[model samples]
Target: MDIQRYLQHIHFAGTPKANLHTLEQLHRCHMLAVPFENLSIIYHQGIHLTPAALFSKIVEHNRGGFCYELNRIFALLLQQIGFQVSFISGEIRARDGTFGPPFDHMALVVTLDQPYLVDVGFGDAFLTPLKIITSEQQPQASGTFHLEHDGDYYSLERRNGDRCSHAKTLYRFTLQPRQPEEFNGMCHYHCTSPQSHFTQKLVCSRPTENGRITLSESKLIITQDRQRKESTLHSHEERLAVLRHYFNIELNVQAA
Candidate 1:
């Protein structure tokens, strides 16, 4: 991959080094610039796991993607910039209080002064990488997150604030190194299976400087300073306009 071109695509201007500051900046820039979207699945455009395909779709075509596409490409960018990055498997926590299958999600572990959990594809997640320390709350603009360890697995949890009664567990992962191709099955499942959420709805979202904007189904929800305002999109033209205006995506597909 062309590292400079990729950096420009993500709007990362400075010279990147493999330090914590650079990592943080890159992560934040990526979260702001590249949205977390599943438009391809809705449009019947197949998801390809190759690096060329990812870079072409995200950078060349100016589009966004879900976890597998986003995290894999971001990992390649980090590796090219001299960071020690590894792919790790995560099982997402379902609403029924059960964890999904292993490799349900892909995340990164970047080793610098210490190992830090880095993820840009989990929509509305921590903007900067969280240090891999269990029980220590790592506060971010989005929310407060912490890692919980149980034997070989580590669970990432988030809470709105100290007043929140329960901490939501986003997903659980292990330190075991993974290969990008190993996630292909789950990626394909997400793109094709009826049980996967990607196949169920059209969601495109990204974080802004003060808040986040999301287009789910026919609703456009913008949250600023913790206040949310939602608008219902009535027509395909309106939905397309919202996608272009809010997420900077110009999709040619009809509503799914």
Candidate 2:
């Protein structure tokens, strides 16, 4: 799986032998190093959901990717590291209050004695894993996150600025293990379809201790304290510069 290459590229210093603590550490480390981005799709490049393709895109090319690509490969790595990882399809709820179909996004539900909603995909949701128990309050670097029971399902919420609001569920997880190649069709649709957000804008994001930094087209957006800072990007070079300097992404000059 070229696991060592990934760990070294991401600068994940932890040992390969897996355990709960190691998983926790990898969760945070991956978020910091590999960004959650969708720039390839925006630049008219094809997106593949295979382990090789994803590893090349992320670890080798030093690029970032969306949920399907990032989480799919992350899930694979977790499996290779001897963790129980399952791939589940998430329905993205946009800022405009619209919901998409299942497989609109992808995330991992990891089981290690206790389960954790492990996602390296969502740009800036929870930096750490969230306990899957319905009654547990999972503390995060950003804030306290809770997952409440809703009959057979679960609802995720986050405490931000003294207000607790609904956070989108990545997926309803099962113990089923999935391979990254299984999601190829869905990934292709997201990268190519006009209805897909990836095709609409060039976006790349990486989590920070405070919030997250997102680059959309020629704009750079940083959020902290629930407040957003945005600035226009005059040219593609400026956009590429922001991505390379800030996110550690090095893409082909013409790609941006």
Candidate 3:
């Protein structure tokens, strides 16, 4: 990995040390610059989990990707910077109060003074790394996030605010270290299976300074200071324009 090029890709400057402060800055910078997108699936481009493929897509080509692609490459970057990082499997919690199968998602656990749950792939979620503490509300610009400990499993939960009626469980994960290849099956599933949401829609989103901008299918949704305004793309040219102007993605393929 060309560490300097990767840092330049994310616009990260200053000398980096494998400590909490550097980790936090790197995490935030990555989130702001790189989007959580699934255009590869939409365009019928294969999603490869290898480091070279991920780096080429995200850093070289100025593109973003889903969890498997984002998190795996991020883990490699962290390891190169001397951070002790490990891949972990997360079972996504669906709206129906059920959890998906193991390895439904990939997240990173970085150990500094303590372990921090670092995830850049989870769109519009926590911006900074969350310390691996139980039941402590970690308030972020995006939302109020917390973790619940259940024996060996830990559930990451989020709420709109303190006054929100209910907390939504984002995903449940264990601390058990995993290899990147362990997530291959689910990665392929997400890219190929019709049941996977990635295959069903076109989603390219990233967090801005105030809120988030999401290109979901033909709709362009921009949320700023908690106020959302949505507009529809009337044509493929309009959709392509939105992609370039807002998301900085210039694709040659026909819009979905």
lDDT of each: 0.92, 0.74, 0.92
Residue pairs of candidate 2 with colliding backbone atoms? 37-65
For candidate 2, report its TM-score: 0.87
- Candidate 3 lDDT over 1-256, as tens digits, reads 8999999989899988899989999999999999999998999989987778888899989999988988889999999999999999999998898999999999999998889999999887999999999857899998888899999999998888783648889999999999998999999999999999999999999999999999999999999999999999888888788889997888898766
Error of 3 at 166 (Å): 1.7
- Candidate 3: worst-modelled 10 consecutive residues by lDDT: 159-168
Better of 1 and 2 by lDDT: 1
lDDT of 2 by residue, 118-211 (tens): 8888776787787788666676767667776655445566665334564544334333446556666777887788987777877788877777
Models 1 onward score TM values of 0.98, 0.87, 0.98
- Report how far residue 236 has shifted in candidate 3, in Å: 1.7
| Cα RMSD, each candidate | 1.0, 2.7, 1.0
Instruction: Judge candidate 3 against the unseen true structure and give its global Cα lDDT, from 0 to 1.
Output: 0.92
- Count steric clashes of candidate 2: 1
Model 1 TM-score is 0.98
Off by over 4 Å in 1: none
Cα lDDT of model 1 by residue, 1-256, tens digit: 9989989988998899989999999999999999999989998999987899999999999899999999999999999989999999999999998999988999999999999999999998999999999857888888899898999999999988783648999999999999988998999899999999999999999999999999999999999998999999999999999988887788888666
